[model samples]
Target: MLLRIDHVGIACENLEEKIAFYRAAFGVTVVSQEVNEEQGVKEAMLHVADGEGGGSYIQLLEPTGPDTPVGKFLAKRGEGLHHVAYGVTDVTKAMAAMGGAGVRLVDEHPRHGAMGTSIAFLHPKDVGGVLTELVESPAPRPEQTKLKNG
Candidate 1:
């Protein structure tokens, strides 16, 4: 089902400040950044390690509006750890298996996620009160392939 630990999400009031903090404190670099309108959040994926191994990321999330999920979370719990994401080869198949096993899900179907990934969320209550995300990463682009091969 799960391939590897993809990224750990952290909710923030200010994405730029958080990104700067991570860069200055941990020296991690931002690999990608995007706003997902459907999710109502702007997010950045920061590379957690360096080298050819291409380590995992720390995802910083900022809500787009007061009514958004991350915004409500900030109002209730303040900025902190949000969710843990695990990589999967196929999120659809993973969701089906998990559903068959009676794991409650927040998303019944996979949706578009950052960096063109397919993603789904599992209910926090069913997963020890921590939000869990299933992510199927997008294929490497031609530029990425060239970089890796060169």
Candidate 2:
């Protein structure tokens, strides 16, 4: 089942500048940052408000190259809200339901996402012009904790 609004993603050319803006404007700092080579982007997650366990966040994305999807999006649209992600209990099941309902999907199957979550995207044309993502992030793995500490 779809759980909650996970985060709102924003595409940008410069991560540091935008990070500074958010830090100053909202008093928020990035909680986590990573470069997903598979996605060809560097992303930072900043907590906006506390949720039941973790919190909701704003995900800042900076494309690694002009060939990446986010890079193409920035080149065309000039940096803005890219997608809204919803947390899900099972991304595969969610995608199945969406496909059965005739929703166009960007991903035919779930793939590893930032922070080791499984994710899939629904095409914007099928979802009222908003690119939507389903994310299923499990509890932090042991390696994740180690990386955070060291």
Candidate 3:
């Protein structure tokens, strides 16, 4: 079982700068900032006014090292849409289904992603050259998020 689009990952050379740009331009509010040493990026999540949970997430990513994946992505493709993350009910089962159908995955299991979500990525080569992310939430529903945060 899968949910809806969790968030879209955007690769940027500077996380804060882009975060500011988004905040000013779109009126989006920064919800969280976290450093995921495992993913090799400093990420900031911007919450859109579309209503609850992760209504539409805008992520600003800056690489931790020159050779990190985001760094490589920047070197090869510059800053832009990095991946489209879709929310899944169960990361493991969703990944299994994708694999059985011959989907190429970037991770063997769900890995730690921004906002404490369990996430996995499908290779662009297998998904029509568009990198797809499968993310599973480890928290309450959107309605709950709205209630708690508001």
TM-scores vs. true structure, each candidate: 0.90, 0.88, 0.89
TM value for model 2: 0.88
Candidate 3: lDDT over CA atoms?
0.83
Residue pairs with clashing backbones, model 1? none
Worst 10 residues of 2 by lDDT: 140-149
Q: Candidate 1's residue-wise lDDT over 29-121, tens digit each?
A: 888899989999999998764333223689999999989999999999999999999888889999988888888889978999878889999
lDDT of 2 by residue, 43-145 (tens): 9988776544335689999999999999999999999999999988788888999999999899878988777789999999999999999988777444345
RMSD to the hidden true structure, all candidates:
2.4, 3.9, 2.3
lDDT of 3 by residue, 56-105 (tens): 57878899977999989999999999888887878989999999999978
Which regions of candidate 2 deviate over 4 angstroms?
A: 140-150
Weakest 10 consecutive residues of candidate 1 by summed lDDT: 47-56
lDDT of each: 0.86, 0.86, 0.83
